[model samples]
Target: MTIGSNSPTRQGQLSVLLAVCLAALILPLSFSGAAMATHTIGQELGGTAAAMNWITNSFMLTFGGFLMTAGALSDVFGRKRIFISGVVLFALASLGLSVAPSLGILNGLRAVQGLAAAAALAGGSAALAQEFEGHARTRAFSMIGTTFGVGLAFGPILSGFLIESFGWRSIFLSGTLVGSLSLLIAIPRMTESKNPDAAGFDWFGAATFTAMLSLLTFALIEGPANGWTSAYVLTLLFGAAAALIGFVALENRVRQPLLDLSLFRYARFVGVQVLPIATTYSYVVLLILLPLRFVGIEGYDEIEAGLLMLALSAPMLVVPLLAATLARRIAAGMLAGTGLLIAAAGLFYLSRIEIGADTMALVPPLLLIGIGAGMPWGLMDGLSVTLVPKEQAGMATGIFNTTKVAGEGITLAMVNAILAAFAASALQQAISGKFNGDEIGAAARHLATGDLARAAHLLPGISPETLAATYGTAFDALIYVLIAITLLAAAVVFGLLDNAKPSEEEANPVVSPGE
Candidate 1:
């Protein structure tokens, strides 16, 4: 583990290491690209607005739900075997997804894709950790981190081009190719690795956790379409509660638990973990809302919206590296808290923006958000584990990551619900005296589904100007509420977390458990 005493990597070892890192990087790249192309897919697929959210949620639900179990499975079985299996599954799913004829089929395939991604992501990183040691390993991981950042930063831009040039299907086709290439490299080169001491798989824990998340997400996404108190929504809410209770009980009784409940006792762990939830919620909510604003409301195409998204993502590329340096000088808690406040400032600024604002008007807030997002993703992650026992570091990382993705999935559904409810109500009230109930309902349905043309067709009696104003008012209110929440989260971070400096070891740890 020393710097100079590092053993030289064998000729082909570096290639295998790099391949594993690339495979890991490919998941985020593909997912982000798909997100950028969502508007195009929605237009072609002919689904409700909520269905578009489902496409993303389906992936996140499985990815976050099964991540810990997937990582453990890789340890118990063989990392190479799991990694290649995941690659194959992901490729096949992407292929099927590209040709999927209905939203139902597409969402099902996306769920499969997420499951595959979880396995590939966990196994690939574990393979890299197992294959190299000391300085060589450090460099290998640094490459992995760099690739990850680069992939996220570039994904939307590339997706924008591909979606414009070829179509949305081209996005999945590229993902299939990347998965296939990774599979080919892994077939011959990936070294098989497993933890000999790893215990039995926590099937009960995984099942309960997955069920809990899926149910909660289901209720949120469906609540607006079906009334909030509808039987379906109520059933899902209760089901999620039951699953959560069962998951806690099961994990406590299990021999090798999937989630260690004891770790939550650390006040620092609890406080630092909040940053991920707030940061992830803030980022993902905008990812969905911003594109809808640009394309659905403002008449920009997919390509234009994708390019604009770079303003939000580009800072993520460099800020983390800079923030890591700052970790050595400033307290991790303070750095993360300050970052949250900056992000809050950006969100508040964005809330004041006119609904009809152009791309140029968005850049400053997006930059501030990107800067804010970058700091916590690195700093909070470091601090979360730094205050914990070394033995529990892996579990802590797992929980932190689970929070990030799971929180994103659940919150996205909530955000979608909020938008749908507010917009529908606002539109209904705006046209109350002008249009009949039937016409108002029809227009609301069309608008809610992102079918602005259809809504226009149904609302001939209403002025387009009036319609735009109604929708804008509702959307702006959502942003205003989100701003309040962001600022509140910043306050919590500043008040609750201790201003403790992270150890040098914490700043640049070799292994990230949930990566």
Candidate 2:
């Protein structure tokens, strides 16, 4: 691609891209790796079910909350300043995570990692906007998204090897090495820039918005554990609701808003936002879900589970890039919509396979889902960049990423809660009144996470065979919901995003080799 050409400007451009992409890998690698590492971490750290959930949740809460604020800060302060600071902090945090003495300390470090990740991601992305133009910008943003997919594709395998060979701390060790390299590459080569017209920080919007997401996630994650109708969960839900209303009101009144609520007026932007939420259920949830099922229920060991995930996620290596290339000629909306329907079909295929089914039974559907998810995943960052004016790149990408990451975080929590409920119901019916609701819910929650040891511990009297069957039944039902979500997203994305192409006058010509 023209991005890697030897001209001095091109060389500098490539350096910026490389640094950002490398930094981009840390989030997905840590996230997908942590999901697979849950049991191993618990074995050493004495994790409770709640603590196990927080392994991912704690990171995402801060990550999702701080993204927009970080982006706006990048635009206000120098992007290079924020970017390098974030990278350095991220490296230090990873080093701390490797030797943390307990789950509490480990989770605290993860939260700090999320805060640093937000700064690194927001600052670096905005900086790259200063370096590229037109089609180059499109490709640059797509590369970032693809880099993340690549991390997701390989994270489980890497974590499994690191954990089995050197223990869980090595996962954090691996991240530290990567962060150090990202910081090194970025320090000398990356340019510093910011929006001249951008105003002071929107503290009210920031505080209210972050508070809303933090409260909502807490409610969702705790609802099942505390009982949905429990006073504790209900109060959290109320606080989250109030915070949301306050956030909306505050955003409308603020001069320089953290979120700029007016952006939703664009049909294309709305369509673009939908893409991430849709993929969360269709693709991201599976990253957490499949590992649990394979390792916990199917009797696959950690490495085997990671290998099985390879079939589901390896298309990140090729398919997303293919989708981006295809977007040049085809309507991107049509491409995304068609791909999601393919995913819905794949989910349906997956729903039929029984427990302990052979690899061939699983591989085909997983591949289809990976291929389907690849299309929308590839389109996100590019569309986000194009929709807003270049000056607001920090805010635009920040909001887009916040939506993407926040959606995944909330959706993961919701999917787990829903699956636990569905599995609990299935367990109750399958066993013909052997257990009460509390017992069933406890077992289902653990089983849903693929913590077979805990699930068994929760239901000492229940046969392992019965628990496995119950989980299998719940998985089928959950897949049905995912299928509906994908299909709905397909239609909605197409309807809103079709005919969203730029006018010929605004379109840039593809660059030629001689130039």
Candidate 3:
């Protein structure tokens, strides 16, 4: 019950893992559910493209911004204390989301949910390291990954059923029900733990880093609508740059900085940073992008769209296993580099497909992309640790994990912004100055969301077919950019990781919490 008290039974430990797994289930579901439900959220809530984006960005932003801080808190305070608080807040946020009357309220609740998610993952995973040992600990930790994959693979189908049967609010309601069950199971059995040698809390460093991420994200999301050259956007960018400078200065001076700024000097470590950025555009972006394209632009229902998405997600279940096997024989960089090229090819193939093509026509490219993306999935975390000195492993893990979740949030925002800009440019060129600047900007945002109907409302005489064609063209251009990013990451990884010898640990990655 208290620090290092030791819960003495396998049954109790498993019970605790069940609770963690349940919480894990809610994490990915919340992410994919918001994506699948964004169009519907917009239909009922009435938000601009930038505003509707808050549906996903608000959640990822706070989750990433606070993730490392939450991990440190679990060590200084008590693991169970922090975890239970997180589960409670996560549950309450879900309940609030179920009855949220406006988009503003929904996104606000989502931001709270992200914060709570960070706490739950940090505390729950740390508690596991205390409760189990050796192989049991590995097994327990692996369950978190398995649970996340399951939630992601099934989230769309489940959320679609909830929406069609009970409307969009039910997605959050599902979170409420699961969170309550997790709380009930974990409370009586959970034990507390802490690191007695933990350093003093770095409040200033945390604040500066979070401010930097927040300002940059806001600038990216709002820049397309406000015009990239607008004074408001420029001011936000300037503030973000100032915050970055302040954060770097603080980290350099602090006794125990949040991030080890010197890690940037290592080629392998810098190359490791590219992995998450590559995946965000190559695969993660589509988690939201395809669902919107299918359901919003192509006139498919939730069920139909979810079913089609299976082609994209199903390969993840098995490919990572093969990737791990291959890593034993081949260098991780070569294996993952090859995979990125494969994914890039898939993107090119996907770009060429006609809009509203049949599911059968779409399956090959989507499946190819999934298989390719899954290869690097298990290698990234391992490389992050093995590339650095063994003494610096902890810092490497912290920095890599931050890049993963926080980097993911920022990258998603950038992808959304770029997509909107491309779509707006396409729209403008098609009509050749028929629409005013405000109308063109608004319509472009709508088009990016795959809301051709709302876009039609903005452009009165534009036929649906023509609008769909324009959207497809813009989307194709975005895919080209994604392909370029992926290939560039592959080249960097192959060159850097070549000098680093392969570790046996590469096959079984050691991930941080809230993965």
Per-model CA lDDT versus the true structure: 0.72, 0.85, 0.80
Q: Compare the candidates by TM-score and give the number of the best one.
A: 2
Candidate structures ordered by TM-score, highest first: 2, 3, 1
Error of 1 at 252 (Å): 1.2
lDDT of 3 at 425: 86
lDDT top scorer: 2
> Where's the lowest-lDDT run of ten residues in candidate 3?
506-515
lDDT of 2 by residue, 200-251 (tens): 8888888888888898999999988899899999998899899999989988
By lDDT rank, best first, the candidates go 2, 3, 1
Error of 1 at 195 (Å): 3.6
For candidate 2, the per-residue lDDT at 371 reads: 88
Clashing residue pairs, candidate 1? Answer: none
lDDT of 3 by residue, 1-515 (tens): 32223556867888898998899899989988888899899989898788888999999998888777776677667778878999999999999999999999999999999999988877776676667543344345445656766776788888888889999999998998999999999999998777666676778988998899899989988888887899999998999999999999999998767776776776666767777777777888998889888988999888788878877777766766566556667877787777888889999999989897877899999989987887776566446555444333334544666677787788888888888888888888998778997897788888888888999999999898888888898899999999998889888878866533234333333322221
Query: Which sections of candidate 3 miss by over 4 Å?
Result: 1-13, 129-142, 264-268, 381-398, 499-515
**Backbone collisions counted per model:** 0, 0, 0
TM-scores of the models, in the given order?
0.88, 0.96, 0.90
Per-residue lDDT value at 78 in model 2 = 86
